[model samples]
Target: MAVPGAFVSSILLLLASAAVAEIQFSEIRSDDRPIIPLDDFGFTHRGWLELNVSGIALSKAGLELGNLGFFLCTRDSWLNVLKELEEEDITCALQSSHVKHVFTFEKLGQRTSFDVEFDQEDANQYTLIFANCLQQQLRVSMDVRSAMYNLDGKSGRRDYLSAGKTILPRVYYLFSLIYFVLAGLWVYVLYKKRLTVFKIHFFMLAVLIMKGLNLLCEAEDKSYIKRTGSAHGWDVLFYIFSFLKGITLFTLIVLIGTGWSFLKPYLQDKEKKVLMIVIPLQVVANIAQVVVDETGPYGQDWVTWKQVFLLVDVVCCCAVLFPIVWSIKNLREAARTDGKAAVNLMKLTLFRQYYIVVICYIYFTRVVVYALETITSYKYLWTSVVAAELATLAFYAFTGYKFRPEAHNPYFAIDDEEEEAAAEALKLEDEFEL
Candidate 1:
């Protein structure tokens, strides 16, 4: 039994009429992500949405064809478009809110439909804009069932996300636990030694505590966000701790590189004033960064402020290097003139090398991680950051254990004149320490 020619002709005429009456769309390939949406863990965001639109149709439900215009929208900017469209006699639902970029198809294309793709940021909602160009009363039916991505595993990429989902939280949490243990042990050591003043022991303890808290924030950022599928407030703490870590790094290098006694007797006031300025500036900068993250695309002012404060922090960190390097050189030269101080000179030289290594390792790993995670989208490099921090901490712990403090000791090997000056200055100083 063959179908009649008249029936086939009638069906073709109906399709042609439908195309003229309303717009139609077909979805195409967008991102190569797996079925599960990847949680960005406070960095390195990536995803996309693509769609193909069939030709528009002109039908008389209640208004003229010339009054209608179709639009595309994404989650964040959809509300703006919707409010504007409503003022223009268009009513759109919030459900139709997923367009980051817009594409217009020529009304006279040879193909019946065209495709449009929107790169996903932190948004996921989509919408279509319908308008009455002539302000005439009209109603239209749109076929939008196939407009979004087909999440039935037919169009998305193969599973690269599942492994990340499972492994990332476990690894981050493991490191966090280790940091917590290290922080606890350091606290115990501080308590036992009765070193509660703003001395080197207390300062290092503070650094260790901040590092532990930072690791915990990272772990929570991964686990809770990945599990609940929403961001938490720990992100702010993460940024704050990160900047503090850099500040402490600067302080640690200066303190260890130039021995506390020399700084205490000669330059305590200058160092304290500079540090007071630097620490507050870093805190404010880090706070701005957090505000920018919270405010998203609308935080340009805060972003600029953050960049400015970051420059301030950088300058402060760099300035500390002068005092550190100068002190190291002076001490090394003084040791050379007196052969009796050779053993201490060797130890001092070794300490200098170790401190330099720690600083270099930290900055190098930070740059690598930032490039890989934020710029290149290689999220696995987060593990490298964790490993580097752990190794740095281990080095610090070993050094501190080996170099216990002794009273009236001359581990720094300064010249006799400098020693006499330091002795005289210490004798004249008040009991209050810097």
Candidate 2:
């Protein structure tokens, strides 16, 4: 038994050493020139290059123009693609110049075949196209092929194609459907009887329509059709409309703030003023971000400007959300102090039904995610926006059910009594002054 055990141990040790030796050999072999010539035109005619499978390579190359060879330089690009595939459970690939020039794939087999073809008869110019090969999987590939071909004019075409066919159109149609349904329902409720909450709901519906229109315009422009959606006037309008979308958030903040102010009348004057001040400041900052993004260093230095805007927007959002949440908490405490159980129940009911506020919070969180994606250029972040909007629409639709005139009568009566008391107090003060 001891002899057998000793023999087994010796075999395991030998296998481990052999594995280490193979790894070391691979590292050494990978150092050799990546490009191997099948035909002897050595420097002149470059042929299909096979990636070295022995070792890991970086993500992107430092040198721009060179013979197609196996090397990776930008680590983030490769990691990002892998992460998207893993996290989303979707197949992904590098298709165009937007991603790094190098492509990375997990070694699944001995060899993987890639097909290449040139459209125009220019030996100097060749396009290296990467397509999705995963069976029954949605693959999102970056627009990175133009860089490989050195095709200046056609650089944006493939990306635009993918955006039109897959991304933008889908988003546009989904949002449009949601907007129409919610808007129609709200209009029907208004015809039955007007509700103040429905006004805000309608406003939200309008926002959805505006967003859908903007996306539609973008999609139409990118689609490769006869009329190449190139209306510069419309483009300018879209830019302005995007800026307005950011401003609209401030409007929501104001609406929520006013609602909170009504619920908490004892808030310090200074705090109230500060909250008001933050609203316009946030609006200005958001507009400035759009301007800077369109006309300033953002065009030249995307990464830096993206980070700056994200930081600013995040700070502003936190500044706004914090006070509102604090005010809501204070209101809840104050409601508890009311002596009558009936009054407390009414207050709790009103508070619980503030789905508008909840929807707005959801919207704010979505904005943060959108801003982060803009900075990081992560494609997956877009799906979050779609989900958020869908949720907001659904919440608003449900909230509309409580818009009957009878529901507001109780609150309105209370409001009238308060107004009468305030008027009487004011008359007393005026008489004393006289």
Candidate 3:
């Protein structure tokens, strides 16, 4: 009798282990996606989501829900309901949101499955939240698959791309073409003025080329993701180009502001210090930008990465301005106390114009465009992006035009006639003294 009892106990223990093995309550992301943000929000015909669940045993996990297994709601609604769920239960929160997708699991300890197709609505961020009305007690594991497809043929946007970002691919392509054209024109100018070209001229050319490639890669990356929800390796290329473009652009801006190659052949100690600070900040900003772009709201630490990106970007913007201020002061003092006041006046005016342009670019891109995005209707969301690109293009054109290599350029170098006149006057005075 004792031997038989031991054998029965071993069998019972095996059965219990097998039963609990199905309960996977950990944060393993292989199957269940608890939170999904609907970036592709629209009004009339948003899209469709096909949801499937398998191997779900919510009740066995010690959840005593009357009927609800899971549900979906707008992000705002989700945030609002959390406090209620903590104070009361999931049912209390459910009563407030009638406009939600609710799924029910009724069986107990059975491997049950249910699939649903929902027509998504609302022009707000939607989220998918799994229901544990009584709060999950056991670690339950389940398989869930969700696929979103578009039904609006007129919008011409894939379901994966958010409505506000629908036109980004086109915008990137257009700007990439523009940058390529400008780069070709710059090459022509450089070849024509090869005798007067400085190292800075080539650096500008490189920046233009990098900008074009960066935009091209970005266009491809967004286009692919919009179509298939995957970058197909374009994202890697985009990241590389984006990193190179960011570093080069800031470096170019700082170098030009200090007149490193044109006004002077080498950087001053302070100028070098500015470069050191700005470059590292740019690197941090770009890395944070990459993290923000790659991670959705559902991803861990997404908001933190976005905040880091914004902070570092603002710091880099402020740091770049210091060199420009130094340049303006030097030009102002030269105009006031030097013999070539008129020449310095021309350079001073150029620097001031550039300063204003930089400030306008930063302000419009950072503040005004964000405000536009927040307030603009969903239909007109792409306009903010267009405005930003337009501002960037204008800034680029103005900087290139003002700083182009040329023989005895008035703003960049002393006028040849002015130099000749000063030399002749000095020679005449020396002859009179002899």
Write down the lDDT of every candidate, Cα atoms only: 0.45, 0.38, 0.65
Candidates in descending TM-score order: 3, 1, 2
lDDT of 1 by residue, 356-387 (tens): 76556556544554444333223244455555
Q: How accurate is candidate 1 locally (lDDT)?
A: 0.45
Which ten contiguous residues of candidate 3 have the minimum total lDDT?
Answer: 15-24
Give the per-residue lDDT of model 3 (tens digit) for 1-434.
01123222222222111010010112213222323231223333666666677765543443444334556554346445654555654444444454375565553345467778877655543444454333323333566654554545776554565555666888999999999999999999999899889999999999999999999998998787667766788989988988889889889989988988878899999999999998888888888977655543334455567668878888888888888889888876665566675566567667778778888888999988877766666556678878888988888999999998877665446677775564444334321110
For candidate 3, give the lDDT: 0.65
RMSD of 2: 17.6
C-alpha lDDT of residue 383 in model 1: 52
TM of each candidate vs. truth: 0.51, 0.47, 0.76
Q: For residue 7, what is the lDDT in candidate 2?
A: 23
> Tens digits of per-residue lDDT for model 2 on 180-260?
666676566656655333345555556555655655554443332212212334545556555566555455454444343
Q: How many pairs of residues collide in each model?
A: 24, 14, 4
Sort the predicted structures by lDDT, highest score first: 3, 1, 2
Error of 2 at 71 (Å): 11
Name model 1 segments beyond 4 Å from true: 1-167, 187-198, 236-246, 261-269, 301-313, 336-340, 374-381, 387-395, 398-434
Which 10 consecutive residues of model 2 have the lowest summed lDDT?
A: 17-26
